[model samples]
Target chain A: MNAMTMIELGIAIIILIGTIVGFLSAIGFLRLPDVYNRAHALSKSATLGVLCVLVGTFLVFLFVEGYFSIKLFLGIFFVFLTSPVSSHVICRAAYRSHVSLAEISVRDDLKEAIIENNKETEDM
Target chain B: MAIQVLANLLIGLLWVFFQDDWSVLTFFSGYLFGLLVIFILRRFLPTKFYLFNLHAMIKLLFLFIVEIVVSSFVVIGIIIRPKMNIKPGIFSMETTLKGDIEVTLLALLITLTPGSVVVEISQDNKIFYIHTMDIPDLSNSVLQSKDRFENAIKKVTR
Candidate 1:
């Protein structure tokens, strides 16, 4: 009973931490200036937040119920795999649609690449 | 190619769960069972089974987890600060990686690892346009980190 309680406590702490991280990521989304900045907060940090929560849930199912939740494991796996792709496509589409970076931001090497790409394609 | 391996792993994992034990014996037996299943279904699969190097894949996964944790803290610190002093920009990086699976994995690793997310890939997939949140020598930092990830990925795919 004592060991189970301890395990439950640990799981609760993990879930709590994940909620905090997710909250922070949301705040970051609202505070950031543009698409790129928002993507940074949403992609990696949010993924981490979800990961912690999913892991906590998985642990709970394993230890408390004495049952393995393959669905939860698959959830963790697919989220980790797709989060980056989702963020990558969003940012790519925004950039391709001529979304300008915020005034406070500096550096844009992609512009040159786009120019060169267009030139190469036109020549073909 | 990677799908077959993932399917096998899923089958193996399912076996462990079905048996309700987390022992190595259970997993290996499950893996053998999955192999038989795959053998019977080989005619239906688009890709053939290949030798999967577990050590390299584990190393890559470990590297990814470590990088994600470290970078998560870094970004969290930046977010919680009073002032958001960030110089976000998109930068192009050239890569030596080839093939669809390798390039895709590398891109995913880059997005997950550092302060960089892949904004775009060139038509030929030889170049990547990366967007990063800071400007205090982050491009080089990203390149160095990406090189580590690339080496790890090559061990698995190539």
Candidate 2:
């Protein structure tokens, strides 16, 4: 058996936990009732999962191999930045396209705001 | 802004590559040197040096990490229940944050917190329309979270 250091064990555990988080997010995405709800699972939880995996591996390379992968750091930053923006854009587009909310949704205060904006545009 | 910071980092990373040095200390020293070099040549540069509110930036990052971890577990709890009883809905909240950067950052932070996603920002950029997965109170909860985020952002921008 190969000798394992504490750092290696920690990295392995983190990656494994990330995998589990990603799996749970996938389940949440599929099980959620509407597009808006699924976007939550995808944007935030999955991003967390990916963040954990990338940071864990980055640490392994940084500590064990003594290789500084700046690209890996960029990957983390870009993923954190882009995922939320993409998900936000998708949600905005869906709402603008007149997608109806699920029947169980308690309220949609945005509808009133959108109607008011439309009325202002008509006046202009 | 992109060219300025990216150029500095690229120079530092290049130093690491050329010397076959993977040490972070080496990279940082090189980065500092690049910063000095850039500062010396700032007169010729187009954009001014990037100003950072380091205190507020660190605070925002800390809040983001805490929110991400806590809300993710909360979401998982909602999903794990045998019966997925929820009050998924969209609500609008007005924010004091102005400018593209502050507004965008606030929206990004809100979405990254797991339970809520920003569906839209109004034309004036003062109001945000958000879709929450399991939030029960629309107005009060929004105000609470909004105050937390808005304060962090106000520090950073102004």
Best by DockQ: 1
Give the clashing residue pairs of candidate 2, or none.
none
lDDT score, candidate 2, position A29:
87
For candidate 2, what is the TM-score? 0.83
TM-score of model 1's chain A: 0.95
Candidate 2 on B43-82: residue-level lDDT in tens? 8988666434557778998988887777777777777788
Complex DockQ per candidate:
0.68, 0.66
Q: What tier of docking accuracy does candidate 2 attain?
A: medium
What's model 2's lDDT at B49? 62
As a TM-score, model 1 comes out at: 0.85
TM per prediction: 0.85, 0.83
User: Once model 2 is optimally superposed onto the true structure by TM-score, how far is the C-alpha of residue A38 displaced, in angstroms?
Assistant: 0.4
lDDT for model 2: 0.83
The CAPRI category of model 1 is: medium
Residue B96 displacement in candidate 2 (angstroms): 0.8
lDDT of 2 by residue, A1-124 (tens): 3445888998999999889889999998888998888888888778889989999999999989999898899999898779889989999899989988888998899999888988999999
TM-score of chain A of each: 0.95, 0.93
Candidate 1's C-alpha lDDT?
0.86
